[model samples]
Target: MMQELRSRKVEESSAREDVHTAASGDQVSTESGGRTDQLRTSGWAAEGPSRPWCRPPPCFSPSSDVEVWLNRLNDYFAANEVPQDKWVAVLKSFVSDEVYVVLAEEGPTATFNELAACLKKRYGSGESELMTWMRFARRRQCPTESLEEFADPFGLCNAAQTFQRFIDEILHGLNFAYAFIDDILIASKTPSEHDGHLRELLQRLTNYGVVINVDKCVFGAPQVEFLGFLICPEGIKPLPTKVQAVLDYPLPKTYQELRRFLAMLNFYRKFLPVLHERQQEGRPPSTTSRRSRHRSLRKV
Candidate 1:
């Protein structure tokens, strides 16, 4: 009986040991799997992550606008988070073979900004400010031309300035009416006052030889839509349609899409109090942040 009891006790102890060993193995396996997942997600695994991609800008040509082309190229690089070291190579890939030869003749460029400056010097319009002002000052109506034809001067790169000056001249000393580019807003407390104001504005425009597009004109509106906002006697507010469009936007899956999403949010940020904070939460880490994280992982 004593021998049998001792044997039973030995068997129980062995069973407990076996269970403990199995549990320990499982714990080790789970820890290893967790570490592997961490490495993969952080892009430090054997395969690493795929390089970011974006659509290349249109090829630069002699006839292309150099400043616009350079702007687009810069946007593409920023969208893809491309390293500065690859800028010259990427620029070379997007040019024609002839343009490529020209760039080669200039020798290797040390930086993207230097290459851009070289392109601007070689291909830009190079119009001086004094020449532009002189052209503006010398503008005049031809004998056979209509008022519209006379007002629109050709080769004037600063059309916005021309429009602003024209509007300011026509609306000078008008207290009740204000003009923004082509849109005019006439404010009055009563219908009679509004009628007077409108007629006065129309007369002034007529005197300046400016013709209004009747289709685009709104007459004495109590509430009006202007520049994506609804203006009423109450206050200005974002259009419901615009708000709905924002709500309907799908989750961004690419860098370009993310940028567009952020831009949309920024436009209405005045209405959204916490929008800036929310945007920061989703923003990708900067290059500096990524490098710091990499250093930390190396230490680990």
Candidate 2:
């Protein structure tokens, strides 16, 4: 009986030691009479009772509407056990600079509700119909040139008709001024003549409440960059900025990368001398050989 009691006490001591080691974030095991027992550090030891911590939401770039991003943010908050009051910092971190600017205007001490309200008010429920129309207008199948022809869809659309009417009403007698959808190109022989024409154009615009963005408008310049093209006395050329973008592009290694590089080069093919030679130079030897093999197989 005495021997059994001592053995039981020793077993309890060994179990206590195992618990202590496990609490200290260490895996522990005990062996007695050829039997083994293991204790793994889990729950409280490593993560400390699952306490709430500030978890930043996924990054929201400037591309999406505020409502869509906010919905995602709300989901993140709920999932991460983030409190409503602590959301401003996370929101600021997750959103774009444009969104952050608007938030800042709402004030630094603004609460999550205030931030959300401000975003909703500023960005609206989502993008408007006019905004959607503008996006569609900007899209071009070919980047080389965008021709605004008064054809089928344009003729049929109410927006186009309204735009055409607006142009006709605004510059009814101005024979020198030419307007095409969003682009307005003014031509004059001399700088002085150009200034007069510009002043007249500005006056008409001002009278009609057509506000122009000064940053986007150019007046009496020797060379002007417009619609991704640099226009000068010599000829219209691809913008130097665009050329620099191509130059700064990284060398391609993978098949996808090679294709992307070739596609970009093709955009400015006219400006690039002996583009066919470059295509030949950039083609991988293995790819060319594979194509030759395929051709031979087809013949067979």
Candidate 3:
């Protein structure tokens, strides 16, 4: 506490360099679909007519250049007698926007100009080169960078029906880092009131063969250390990082020391609520035990 809030900031926020990818598509019809009226009443509990692939049913495997990979997916399904939910999930990872556009453009074999125009109209920047976009999506299937955001034109958080539709946008050549995060971290809990999001997470984890260390874990326990933070029941407490920050903190014997400590925990003050008001910044928090009280002796 006293040593380092006064030192230099450690985690400096640097501007990320202007960064990268490419995609092509026409202006996507952002209009509400035929089912809009039915889906509007309740959150996700609304009753609706059944439709293939739009409902919770497994997505159909389409023939494409990706068929080789798809075959492996089929084998996995056959090899594992997982629950229906997990089965449904692995199946969902197949279809993607790149697949759709590739099949669409290849069959009709539209002129480059037409394809570009359609892509631009549907996908703005993606229209400049539809094939390029498709290849890029295939080449880099990492969901975040792909066109998933574009698929739902109208973002619907609870729409399982839309999951296939949205996922189709970026299901190819998947980068899958976030997928790992989803399995290991996000899904390792009980279902919340939010339509069993926890179940969905764990379900996905099951598909990926991801396991949670139960003894090391706090099942449904709020505030476990993940990647290094106390993700609490209440909210993200980040206990490990805070302790680290304090332990790693420099002494504030000088004015500079205060700034350094501030930099370390500036983003974390909410968790370290005691901060200055509680006079918690005097000693290094990690090593704090008993305060040495000085007895003032009066000359008799």
Candidate 4:
């Protein structure tokens, strides 16, 4: 019994020693391998913990102050010509269920002035009955008719009726839109679904020979960059391009041209309204100070 007890004690001592040796071995290996380089680094921290001491702060927000940081970052990206190729991928994964829409309607027979006016009223500067007519005039397989002929103001059930088969099957559950000067795109999950919407829109646009850039297209992201601005699956953010486009716009050389621009900015009233009225009235915005002018015009 005495011999057996002694043996058990010895065994336990050996086990403890082995555990100590193993831990000691790891420490020695870490210290020995660590290279001392000229570059400054948290070398002590590197050897210390398996986990980091602190996580990085979040990178973005909605305030104008935060915009300064983003502008710098975006500027770096733009100046480098480093195509934000991965940007699309990041946005796709971020907002996976969003969709973007583009509408392309053809002119069946309306002349430049009348069709142009209808386009303005229905889809242009204001969302009026005429504006709704723009939606009808551009919808997929929309019937060919003069704006005057439509009994329904919006035209979902007017001269150009919404096709039951198309809407019931496709575009049933998609939201989000991106409108260019003459066309609009509806974005969503499964390029296949979007394709269905596109086919209808394009059929009309094809008659007009309008070309769409498929490369800039994306689907199934919780967030996406559209018309050079970020739109989430649920939220709407007007692209910087949309706003900048307004600011950089040149004063028209003629009264008619001024009317055209007025028609254009009429829809952007929320962003800059009374001032927009001034611009519409033919006052040239001086390059030195648009902001002050914008403020002055607002007071007026």
> lDDT of candidate 1 vs native?
0.46
Cα lDDT tens digits for candidate 3, 212-241: 444443344333344344434444445664
| Model 2 residue 181 distance off true place after TM-score fit, in angstroms | 4.4
- Model 2: per-residue Cα lDDT over 37-142, one tens digit each: 1111211101112312111122121221111122222332212121222222322232221100000010022222332343345446542333333322322211
Winner by lDDT: 1
lDDT of model 1 at position 155: 35
* Ten contiguous residues with the weakest lDDT in model 3: 97-106
> Over the full model, what C-alpha lDDT does candidate 3 score relative to the true structure?
0.31
In order, candidate lDDTs are 0.46, 0.42, 0.31, 0.40
Candidate 2: how many backbone clashes? 0
Clashing pairs in 2: none
Residue 248, candidate 4: alpha-carbon lDDT = 90
Off by over 4 Å in 1: 1-148, 153-155, 288-300
- lDDT by residue for model 4 (111-215), tens: 233334544553455424443433333211101111122111221222232221212223234333333333344655666776676566556444433344555
Pairing residues by index, what is the TM-score of model 1? 0.47
Query: What is the lDDT for 37 in model 3?
Result: 34
Q: Model 3, stretches more than 4 Å misplaced?
A: 1-122, 125-223, 226-228, 234-236, 244-248, 253-257, 272-300
Candidate 1 lDDT over 100-132, as tens digits, reads 000001111122233234334543634233323
Cα RMSD to the true fold for all candidates: 31.6, 24.3, 24.0, 28.4
**TM-score of every candidate:** 0.47, 0.37, 0.27, 0.25
